[model samples]
Target: MPDSPYVAMGPRVAIRHTERNDRAEFTRLSRTSAALHHPWLTAPSTDEAFDIFMTKLERDDHEGFLVCLPETGAIAGFINVNSIVRGAFQGGTIGYGAFAPHAGHGYVSEGLGLVLAYAFGPLGLHRIEVNIQPGNEASLALVKRYGFRLEGFSPDYLYIEGAWRDHERYAITSDMFEAQG
Candidate 1:
């Protein structure tokens, strides 16, 4: 709550790297938010799973951030930028979720706007992609709000829960992002 080092701050939320100290609160939120997250994502809810998630952040290609409310420094969601390529690619894929308690309150919209600025500005990325399941209207809307163009569709894209899920790809290049902004 006190002395939290934030990476970015917006009107509705703040962003920061997920630390080992976040295990308890993050896991609790993930567990309780399952009803909202089910069929979409299964966030790391156990100690072992949280350990694995932390390891992903150690790699050069991945980064994990927590979306926290400024009032009390409480986590309301999470966003992960994965498979970052720094050379000619200069691109990454993003995965994100809003905890049930914070869902529909527009925190993701505000927080993700800051994520985009951070990615395109500080991270020096040229393009960012978000893949969403066809049925997930909420995710689709979130990307569209940021002006991510519908790129394509991937059948059996990512394996989630038990089966491979189809995903609709959406992306925004730096030029497109700047033009829209």
Candidate 2:
């Protein structure tokens, strides 16, 4: 457990489900992050990536949103709640990235609170998980701020930046949020 600079910082933020009209801006930001963090993804043409992103946006069972700064109308970050499973589990995995310029501003932290509320409150999801690369200290800290518990480490969990990387799994349950509330 390393100390986190984002333990408590930044002005609060709000997020809204990404709309069809937001596709162009979302695509630009996501692509920029991918280029910086996972250059191998650069080969995909914008249209090709837009199609893939639209698929995520169109799913009813899943959610994708952009974190917006009220004053500037800037998109600080984006989050996705995907692979939702119901029945005995009733869980989903969360994925997110901050716009390059917004990194380290605690924007994602505030946006995370909103995501958790939506996940546990409106979405009726019982549990949400986040998988972070071992080296992504910022993301790990962001998830921790929302009370996600370290579950385990997985090898070859995901392929990004042209190579497979290990991931640290963290999970939070609706019960925990309810108790905290």
Candidate that scores best on TM-score: 1
For model 2, name the residue pairs that clash.
none
Q: What's model 1's overall lDDT?
A: 0.90
Cα error, residue 136 of model 1, in Å, equals 0.2
Output the worst ten-in-a-row residue range by lDDT, candidate 1. 1-10
> Cα-based RMSD of the predictions, in order?
1.8, 7.1
Give a tens-digit lDDT track for model 2, residues 71-156: 66788887789888888888999887777678778887788887888888778899999888877777777887778899999998
Per-residue lDDT over 29-139 for candidate 1, one digit per residue giving the tens place of the 0 to 100 score: 989998899899989999899989999977889888888898898788999899999999999999999997888998878888878888999899999999999999999
Model 2: residue 126 alpha-carbon error in angstroms: 0.5
